[model samples]
Target: MEQAEIQAHQSTYEKEIKDQLDIPLETLWQDAPIEPNWGIKKNSDGKNTFWFWFGFKGHLAVTTKSQYITSRLMTSANLSDSKVATPLLKKVEDQFPEHFTTAILDAGHDYEPIYRQLQGDQMGAVIPYNVRNEPLMP
Candidate 1:
């Protein structure tokens, strides 16, 4: 087979894998719920030092170089950041499909499924989870 043919085969395989794992955006939105009455308080030295008195916590998607927030998702504080990644990403894709070239995420957003989905779209994912105890480059 020619090099172009091999590349096409590889691309087709990746698309199939992505399709199998993709979750509909509507489903994702329905699954994520907001708690209006939720609150948190942390006490230190006999005084309240930190408080989330009401409302859900927010997950923000910002441009790495610009530091501008592009999108936001509200979720219960109890939810992990990783869980919100997909839906938030879908929203971003819908709004600016051609603008995003890379996704720079923290350790909290490190997950295999997320990485796979991002890469499948030709988006660079910079998540350092250290699953194999290997040192990450600086």
Candidate 2:
């Protein structure tokens, strides 16, 4: 009920939380043996409000090179995960444009508008298409 008590409690809480995160913190930055994928976490506290029942979506940018999350964004408590990746990608790109030269993703990131945008840049993406009809390397 007093400022001193609150301050002491806050400091203890902070230290406790930091102490709890040691393993995951180190693991998050470890070098990876394989590429990673972007994710959308479905927050389960929602949909229930509307009688449907779904949670939240957490959009994250993971480093395929390091298997680490470079960045993330928690969408409005009601938005879809798919709806967040694009904006989140833009945010990540704006913050670290140098990190992406050739961005490769699954069919999802191959949106026509996005493809056109990436095409204009030096981004070499392996999007889905009629590769069968395309010329092979000589």
Candidate 3:
């Protein structure tokens, strides 16, 4: 929500919060309109390519039985895990509502727009939220 919407930029990341603004934004994600960001970072076992680095975010959903990937999405190297996830879930819901009515997402999935859409659509979604931002608890 930095208001960088119009610009054709994507895959924004930094080593430190202090270093956030200085970087030149070299890459663009495969998907446009990426909102929230999520991914784990490790320097390839600390090998330090230094040349290569971006968040690796992917979507893998399974049935309650842990049998198979009900639906999955492998995002471009640099994009928010949450951004890719919501759309995938929405698509699944749209195409096969009978197969998927309720969805459970990790705390990373807690975003205002996604949450609102799920609620508005009357879809069951279990989303874990960050404790500090817990509006429902108090």
Candidate 4:
């Protein structure tokens, strides 16, 4: 493709990534309770990025050994992933008491409260550092 064509394609790709859907609301039909929400994406360097979309997010608790999903929660895309972690874990814990000993999550769930909740339940947390969440020096 020509340079202009490449640039145009890149622009279109970026636009699509930013706004996943552009359908007319009047023409759209939905049976489930869906909502528009923004989500974060970590780059290769672990830097925080963002995107907007209209849909639901599926939070699940899976077993490492059996690779089976024990608990699941579906929420609007606007819901923070961190917010769902504890509840999902609680569901699993309540459903299958003492079945899991650890919770492995990504940097998106690097919140301190999540850590405390897991610790309170005697569960280990393995979440990486999310620098974006760190407090800046004065």
Query: Which number leads on TM-score?
Result: 4
lDDT of 3 by residue, 43-80 (tens): 43457445444544456767776657766666555555
lDDT (C-alpha) at residue 114 in model 2? 51
Candidate 4: stretches off by over 4 Å: 1-50
lDDT (tens digit, per residue) of candidate 1 on 20-108: 24667766666566756555655534575876655677899898788988989887665556677777788788778868989988765
User: Which window of 10 residues has the lowest lDDT sum in candidate 3?
Assistant: 14-23
Best by lDDT: 1
Determine which window of 10 residues in candidate 2 has minimal summed lDDT.
11-20
Instruction: List TM-score per model, in order.
Output: 0.63, 0.44, 0.53, 0.65
Lowest lDDT 10-residue stretch of candidate 4: 23-32
Give the clashing pairs for model 3: 37-80, 38-80, 38-81
- Every candidate's CA RMSD: 12.0, 17.1, 10.1, 13.8
| Clash pairs, model 2 backbone | 41-58, 42-56, 43-55, 43-56, 44-55, 47-53
Error of 1 at 95 (Å): 1.0
**Model 3, residue 12: what's the lDDT?**
36
Candidate 3 residue-wise lDDT at 96: 58
Better of 1 and 3 by lDDT: 1
Q: Global CA lDDT of candidate 4, please?
A: 0.63
User: For model 4, how does the per-residue alpha-carbon lDDT over 44-116 read when each residue is reduced to its tens digit?
Assistant: 5745765556767887889999999897767667666665665666667668878789999998888777777
